[model samples]
Target: MDVRVLGRGPAEPFLGAQDLFETEYDLSMPVRVRIRRDPDERTWTGHYPDHHVLNISAQAATSAMARELALHEYAHMRRNEEAHPSHTQSTAEALYLALAGRRVERRKLTHCYQIANHMKDIYADDITLSVAPADKLVAFLEASLATALADRPHDPPRWQRLTPAADPDITAVNAAFALALCERHDLLTPDHRLYDLAHAAADDAPGVSIERFKHRFKTLVDDPDESEYRKALVDVTHQYAVETGQAAD
Candidate 1:
């Protein structure tokens, strides 16, 4: 496999990450590592059957966390190669089928996609954590949730619903994702900071049951066949729509 780093930024970290990931998984395709300067654009992987690209923001590539981030994206690339349901299926179609005839708000429907994405992340992290330490990934999640919680409104105005970042449902799903990751990796402890933030999110969005979504996503069977994964997606979408009062009576 040809792995090329295409940036002025240091290539050692990314190349080292490729070596680590290749130990556990076969990277059969060529890979290009592109570094961009956009802070808001996160490190992500784009995959085609024959080749893949791992794009990292300049800020992230320069940071010590680059290897961890690259490993996570590499796991995603591996899953894509394997045709994993989380990486292959249409989340929107699953939501439409799950909530058929129910008029869902566009915002709520969007949240469903985020929930589905959390599932994908969980599976990808499973592969990553197997090959690397979980400390960096765990720390990243903690810092992200802490920031979001600090920025959240004590009581968001009804008008803030127009923004997903300000939407309580979005926060609830975010919290669920945090909880699901902790659960899947057995990272939770009584003193862990995530416990409090997740509880705060749950209390803030009483209409959305964080546990329900957390359980559904966290317990998804590894290497699930298409039907099983689709069913899981449908179930979570329907549950989220109903909980958020998106179902037309």
Candidate 2:
């Protein structure tokens, strides 16, 4: 496998990450990696499966976050090669629920995509951590939780300004709950601080309790039964729409 690092940044760190990823995983084809700064980029790194390109943000590269990002994206690339019927099914169900209603707006549909993508992240994180070093994975999870906690509002407004009906607090809690579920399942190490932060966020969100939220999240991502998984997705999407005042007709 030929791994090339492009664009300007600290080449050594990125090269080191590439070396580690190549050594740990088998790549049958060439892949291009680059680091670029984008203020609007929502992720630390993204994998373009079709182009076989991986892009890491300059900020993430400088902070040593590129290592995990690379490995995570590599896992995604590998998964792309091996078909996952379950992911395909679940994603389809979520999208159907998200767009089933006549009231669906672009932003609302985008929010559904966000939730579905995060659901995929849980599976990808599992694959990456399976082969990657446990300590390194733990460190990455810790850093991720710390960043989420820092950026989260202590008392968020009931609804986002742009999406008046969508409760930002609930969305944040759901995201945190996904990570917390990973920790619970041993994909990531359990950290009291991370759990506390998730719990606190749930507490502040009306009608959301920590334990109940965890159960729903687990059902959404980890449930073995396909029917139950679809049901969970429907329930989650319904809740989001209800909270946002965009319930389907």
> Best lDDT goes to which candidate?
1
TM of each candidate vs. truth: 0.92, 0.71
Residue pair clashes in candidate 2: 165-244
Best by TM-score: 1
| Number of colliding residue pairs in model 2 | 1
Per-prediction CA RMSD (Å): 1.9, 4.6
Instruction: Please write out the lDDT profile of model 1 over residues 1-249, one tens digit for every residue.
Output: 577889768888888888888778867788899998787777878887679999988888889898888888888888898889999999878987898888877777777888888889989989998888777887888888777777776655563254434566678788888888877889878789888888887877888998887888778898899998999889888888888775685
Can you write out model 2's per-residue Cα lDDT over 141-236, one digit (the tens) per residue? 556555655555555453335433434444554546655546555654455455665655565555544465455655544434556556666666
TM-score result, candidate 1: 0.92
Mark the regions of model 1 whose C-alpha exceeds 4 Å error after superposition.
Answer: 156-165
What Cα-based lDDT does every candidate model obtain?
Answer: 0.82, 0.59
